[model samples]
Target: MSKEQVVVARKKKKKVKIFPIVNVILFLVISLIIMVPIWKVIVDSFDAKAGYGMNFLPQTFTLGGYSSILSRVALYRPFLISVVVTIAGTFIGLLLATLGAYVLIQWEMPGRNFFAYMLLFTMIFDGGMIPKYLVMKDLHLLNTLWSVILPLSINVYNLVLMRNFFEGVPESLFEAAEIDGCSPMGTFFKIVLPLSKAALASIGLMYAVQFWNDYTNFKIYINKNELFNFQMKLRNMVMDNDIPDEGGIDPNTIANAAVIVAILPFAIIYPFCQKYFVQGVNVGAVKE
Candidate 1:
């Protein structure tokens, strides 16, 4: 080959390398834009310097924000209530979603298509707040945690995603289970459920996050402060701008602390389920 051709190939390789480096730099810049704000909040929560404006880093690392929140005996009850509601709601919701998805994917099930359409219909439309409130009142679920749990137990979108995952499971396995005289329940528990960890993790994480962040239903149905969840309490604190502290701690610090506390569960949970969550999203997107 000529020296000119060899030099041209070298230039092409250098260009290719430069393109990837540029892309990497761009991605890094975008990631920092997103992450810096979050890190700022976390740092400011522990910052002891009394101020209202943003500090790029912790001005003075102290537990004043955390202490202000922890000192309030009132905060614990709401925290506990939120934990219970999130755990119970996520479990029950996952159970119902799994069963519903399994049933929808069954080819022999009569009226499955109609039922699926009905579920989709509910997704597209919902009765207004007044009507839902009236229904809850009639059911005697008002002023109770079940008021929140029952209404959001099974999200139609999550159900459809799970159904798609179930469909992706090989038909041969179901047939083999049937040949062994396994009941539907047995097949689901032993065969389907075990293999559906990716879908379950993704959907369960969705439910957990929803339950954790729920505030509207709690505010509407629950009139009693004692029945309030962490989100409801946090909302009250934010609106009232009253952190129960005699010490002159910065309110911004308290607010930032509350924000971190509110999202901590999700931050901890997502990393563990991230692999499954991504896999579930991709697999569920494929057309059956």
Candidate 2:
């Protein structure tokens, strides 16, 4: 190679190394930014002496916060309600997404495009709050868990993702199932579902997280305190200073503990689903 070209190539390699180093530094900074508040919350949750400030570690560490929250019927009841709603909503959401996506993949189905477009249209627009409220009231679902569960379960984005993943599946396998005298439901259960675990896990995780974290629906539709979910309770505790006075523990500590409890389920669940989540997102975004 010419001397100038060799020197230029060396300079380009040096520039490429700088880019990766910059990216690493950038990501580390971003990670630190996100983790700092989380770390503060964790520290404060255990800090009996926790107050209004940035605390890296607890001055007086205690489980008083968790004990106070967990011991209360008010907190636990809402938590149980959240758990039930999350599980039910996730199941129903996955079922609808899978069934709808499977149907959309059937080339010969009548009005397939129409149905797909209708779902897509929802992604673009929604009936305003008054209309939705009236519909829920008419259905007699207001002030009930179903009011929250049913609305969050119908996610068009998840449906579209599942459809994309289904489209990527080999047509030959479906044809083979048909030739073996398998019904549509049989093929879905035996052939399609077995292969779409990644999509299911990813989409199901999304549904679970959505249902678990939802407060607005519960707040708007459910006036009765008994029907409130964990997120709603957490919102009340954090925003409205509604923490029950117990053990003389700091309300800040209890609030932080409640926050941790609210997020704990998903944090424990995500690591196990991480691989499938990544794979599912990639596959669902791309078509063959």
Candidate 3:
């Protein structure tokens, strides 16, 4: 090779080597940005003497923070109630959203445009809180767990997202199923549902997280303390400034423990759905 050709070869090699090094550095910086705050919280939860300042790691490690939060049986009841509500709500919400989306996506359905418009209208405008409260009261759902679950069971945005996914399914599959004498319901369950797991997983996680974090509905409709969700209990604890103990454990420590305890379940559950969740949301990236 000539001198110019040799230099060009060296330039290409240098470019290839530089790209990976730059990528690694960028990735490390982004990872630290995301992980540091979470790590700080984890460490602070374990630190018994975690005062006003945040710590990089546990200073005086102890279970005092956790013990303080857990010692109150009040917190435990709300935790269990929240768990039941989250599971039940997630299931019910996902079912309704999937079914409703499936119905709406059918091009032949009568009044489809009108119904779709109404669903979209709900996304923008809702009956204010008092009207919703009255509706709940009139339905005799007051002070019941169903009050929380039933009122917000179907999210319009999630329904629309699922519809987008359903619309992307090949029309030929539906035609094939119909030729085999499959009913609409059978087609939904056998073909559409089976092929739509990614969309379902993504929407289900969104509903689950919303139900888990919800406190406003419970606060408005539920007066009974026993029916309060975990977030409600945590709010009471934080707002009332009533730390469980006075002897040694600091209030901030207990607060940190409550934060971790509240967050732990979602963190544990997210990993199982992480693989499908990303791909599901990106189902129709390039719409033609």
Candidate 4:
């Protein structure tokens, strides 16, 4: 290369003078703070033989805590219920929210603003729990999987985010699709959705997290232990004072183990959705 070109390349390769030692020290301190509790719980799950003691690391390690909960009827069933409900609820909620948001943006539609207001209104106001229960009872949606899926089938805040996302899409894209003799549904599926994947991805993560963490509706509307969700069961493990009737495992171990299991899936799912969210928002691909 020529001398001028070499100098230019060197100028472009500018480096910052960050202190590597200080950064490493800070990182280690933060990592220890986060990992300590997680490590403690994992150790506690193996602490069945410790015989009533508390410490950061287990003095007596056994898998009894994990085994006992896994073997229980109420416990495992709830885990399954939570998984099924989260998946079903997330998908259905996404479909309804996306479709509704898209249609509300159609200027030609009658009562579009009124419907938008209605949806927005739900974000700020809600009927009391008792009234909601009565309505659910009247609808005969109580105690079924539908009970979990139906009441929270839509969220107004999410609808707004989706509407904003769809509106951010370009008018020319929609116009081009129309010019090509595409129907509304076809244009939406081919052009709008393909470009709006980031918004869809972000909304999907939000819905999944909300549904996965919720147990209140189930507690109020459901009477059967068989229908308990992962969160409700975790609540029991932490709050319920009852020891095992057979007396093999203690309450603390069960509580900690349940806490760990209940949270582990989210720890896995969020980073995945997060990566897509950052990508989608930055590219403006989801915007109209």
Candidate 5:
């Protein structure tokens, strides 16, 4: 090659290398921007002397903040409520998503297209908040845990994701099941569900997170304080200065500690679910 061509080739190689380097630096900077505040919160949660200022490490490391929040009898009801709501909501959501997705995949089922369209319509629109509230009242569901659980349980996005995953199941499996004299429900239980562990874990985690983090529904629908979930109680603690007195622990410390406690479940659970979560999302998202 000519000297000029050789120089151009080297420059091109240098440019290619520079792009990846720039991308690495860009992502690192973005990661720091996101993680810095989270790290600060974590630090403050442990810091008995936690204040409003930025802190990378706790000046006075202590678990008193956590102890105070946990020991408070007032928090117990809300914590239990949150656990019940999360478990029940996740179960119902998964049941609806899986069953509805299965039915949508039955090519011979009458009104399948119409049903799918109706569900899709809901994704585009809904009755406004007041009307929904009125409906809940009419159903005599207000001020109950069901008021919180039922409203958020029917997520159309999750339904669509599950349907997509179900569609990805090989047709041959169904044919084989049919040849073996298996009923539709039997095939679903034996074949479809067995093959859908990843999707279930992925979608279940989504439901659990949504239900766990929910506060607005609880705030709006539940009038009884005893029925309020952890998120609701946490909001009260953080926003309304309602932290329970635990020997005059700094309110900031308790609030930060509560924040950590709130997120801790997912922090521990996500690592275990991550492999299945990634696979499920990928399979549900991609198509031939």
Candidate 6:
């Protein structure tokens, strides 16, 4: 090769390395941005020595903090409540969303366009918090589990995404099933749902996250302490500032531990769901 060609090739290689280095640095920075706070929370949650706030890292580690929250007085009753709500809500939400999406897209029902528009409209405009509260109150759903699950049974965005997923199933498969002994219900179970598993897995994870993090609905709709969701309880532990000093544990410990607990479960579960999550979320984003 000519000397000029060799120099140009070296320069291009160097340029490529530089771009990759920059990208790596950017990713590291963003990771730290996410990791730093989480590390602080986990550390502070156990840092009985650091007092109110964490500094860099904990000087001491103690299970005392975690133990206190689940101790006799605390026992994390709210966490149990949250767990039930989250499980029920996630399953119910996924079921309704899947069925609603399937019916919306595959069926030749009356006023199909109107129903779709109504759902689409919900995504754009809400009945506002006051009206929603009033409706729930009138329906006698306040302070009940239904208050959390019913109002958001079918997330409009999730429904649309799922509908897109259902539509992506091969029409030929449905036709073939129909030609056999399969009815529409049989076709859905035999053909549509099997192909739509990834979408459902992904949406189920999304609903799980929503259930875990939801507070506004719980706050407005459920007033009972027995019914408090994890986020709501964690909010109280952190924001209330006057936690009345449970047993021997200090205020800092309660706040730190609660916040850490609130965040930890999602961190553990999200990666498992990411495979389908990325696929499900992206499938609806582009036109075929």
Sorting all predicted structures by lDDT, with the top scorer first, yields 5, 2, 3, 1, 4, 6
TM-score of each: 0.88, 0.93, 0.86, 0.78, 0.93, 0.85
Between candidates 1 and 2, the lDDT winner: 2
TM-score of 5: 0.93
lDDT of 5: 0.90
Better of 1 and 6 by TM-score: 1
TM-score of 6: 0.85
Q: Which ten residues in a row have the lowest lDDT in candidate 2?
A: 279-288
Question: Which segments of model 6 are wrong by more than 4 Å?
Answer: 1-22, 52-54, 73-75, 107-110, 242-250, 284-288
lDDT comparing candidate 4 with the true structure = 0.79
Return the clash pairs for model 4, or none: 46-62, 168-287, 168-288, 169-287, 169-288, 170-288
lDDT of 4 by residue, 142-161 (tens): 88988878777778877787
Q: What's model 3's overall lDDT?
A: 0.87
Candidate 5 residue-wise lDDT, 1-288, digit = tens: 999999999998887567889999999999999999899889998887789999888998888889988898988999999999999999999999999999999999999999999999999998889999999999999989899899888998999999999999888899999999999999999999988999999999999999999988988899887888998888877898887666646778999999999999999999999999999988654343
User: Which is the winner by TM-score between candidate 1 and candidate 2?
Assistant: 2
For every candidate in turn, the CA RMSD to the true structure comes to: 2.9, 2.1, 3.4, 5.6, 2.1, 3.1
lDDT per residue for candidate 2 within 1-288, as digits (tens), equals 999999999998887557889999999999999999999999999999789899888999899998887887777888889899999999999999999999999999999999999999999999989999999999999988889999988889999999999888888888999999999999999988988999999999999999999988987899998888888888877898877776657889999898898899899999999999998987654343
The residue pairs in collision within model 3 are none
Error of 5 at 158 (Å): 0.5
Q: Highest lDDT: which candidate?
A: 5
lDDT of 3 by residue, 1-288 (tens): 999999999998887567889999999999999998787778888887877676887888888888777788878889898889888998999899889999998899999999999999999999899999999999999999999998778799888888888888888898999999999999999998988888888888888888899999999999998899999999998889977674676788888889999998889999999988998888644232
Evaluate model 1: give its TM-score.
0.88
